[model samples]
Target: MSSPRRRADLFLDPADDPREGGPSLGDERATLTEFLRYQRLTLELKCSGLDAVALARRSVEPSTMSLLGLVRHMADVERGWFRRVMAGQDAPPYYRTDTDPDGDFDGAVPDPAVVADAWEVWRAECAFADRFVAGAPSLDVTGDDRGELTSLREVLVHMIEEYARHNGHADLLRERIDGRIGQ
Candidate 1:
């Protein structure tokens, strides 16, 4: 009938899944955290074991997307929503600016230093976000998104959506690179 849904080559082992054992049946905050954590781990897994060149390899012509770009982009996203918006910090973007709107993707060169910096920033931002969420009194904590007062609940959901979408992209990108595939 149908060929196997998964390719026999390079799939992630179930035992290595980072999303395993999260509070799937927990309350809203726990659920959101679990989902976000899954997405974050998926991003990391997809990018694992690649050198700077592979990390910066473009997916296709006219598109600047790459695994390295995704890492940098997520760093900015975590910083933006969690620190700047939610915590009202004065932090600016890590990889974007007024002149370079796509700096995250565009600056993803095949340089080990760049890749290392991106990972460092992304991990730090994630840690900060985790702290903010844990210390938050409630998901109802309001943050100014542009001009509207948005709740932490909305931001968490949006972050999950963002990572989910990008992780899909990462899956495709990684597959294109080395035939790796999995959830």
Candidate 2:
């Protein structure tokens, strides 16, 4: 019998992955944005076809890292680096509090409404970040992050790294949930 991971439909063929590196390379901005876009998409792909219960499943005990929690956490991350730090807006965290700093992940319950809300907020924050990056005068534009002046370029690189690391976690989590795995 074929294992679920070997099921053709559960995983995309390697040749068809959008993140597959191409022969041609673009400028720094394009390259960074493209990488970030695919990393974000990978997170979505990892969590695809799962219900709220599956989305919020913490297969790794003592760790609150669920797919749903990742989404909420990324939303807060996007809002912080882009809106609060770069855009100089007073935007607070979407799912964090002083008393509950890990609210994003801890509050990732298996509720349909919570899942939907997390997706909505995450998407909105992503859109905001895209606009902010596109409209920035230069990647060298600096932002004050807790008394440290950081450039947009640094933030972009950091974000890409952050997503890539989390996506690795997502891959393991997805595999635990179902034998599905790829990319």
Candidate 3:
């Protein structure tokens, strides 16, 4: 787990093309946000065109990693990082509680409503995170995390890393759910 912070470094310079991987050539804030968005989009792409069954299929036996579960978990993560930590709010866990921390992944059943709700929550959280970053003053802005101050730059980088890691799981789960592969 990492601390979240508020920062407004999402200014896209007029010269830098936002389409390209912002890491290659862009301002620090734009690059970080772009990369994070890319990873988030990758997760959505991997889950696209799938129904409840496909989304909820536990492709990896002995492990409960499913597309639906990933969406639910990411929704929780986004809410935890952005709403709770960054905004210093007491937002309750979206899917899990302290007693049942794995509820997000465990409760991912093959139901259309469950899938729909997970996607909706995930998208909403992502949008909220974007808006939070957009409204921040600077990447240097700090937030308190368990008594420790953390910078927005660190949170953004950690978010990108988190999505990339989960997207790897999504790749495997997607391939197992359907024969589709590549990118």
Instruction: Please report the candidate that would top lDDT against the real structure.
Output: 1
Best by TM-score: 1
Compared with the true structure, model 3 gives a TM-score of 0.85
**What would the TM-scores of all predictions be?**
0.95, 0.91, 0.85
**All candidates' lDDT scores?**
0.93, 0.91, 0.83
Backbone clash numbers for all candidates listed: 0, 0, 0
- lDDT by residue (tens digit), candidate 2, 43-108: 999988999999999967799989999999999999999999998899999899999999999999
Who is ahead in TM-score, 2 or 3?
Answer: 2
Q: Estimate the lDDT of model 2.
A: 0.91
Error of 2 at 74 (Å): 0.6
Q: What is the lDDT of candidate 1?
A: 0.93
Off by over 4 Å in 3: 1-24
Report the C-alpha lDDT of model 3 over 1-183, residue by residue, as the tens digit.
878864432223436533444466778888888888888878887887889999999965688779899999999888988888888988787899888889999999999999989999999999999999989899988877778888889889989999899888887787776666526
In model 1, how large is the Cα lDDT of residue 107? 100
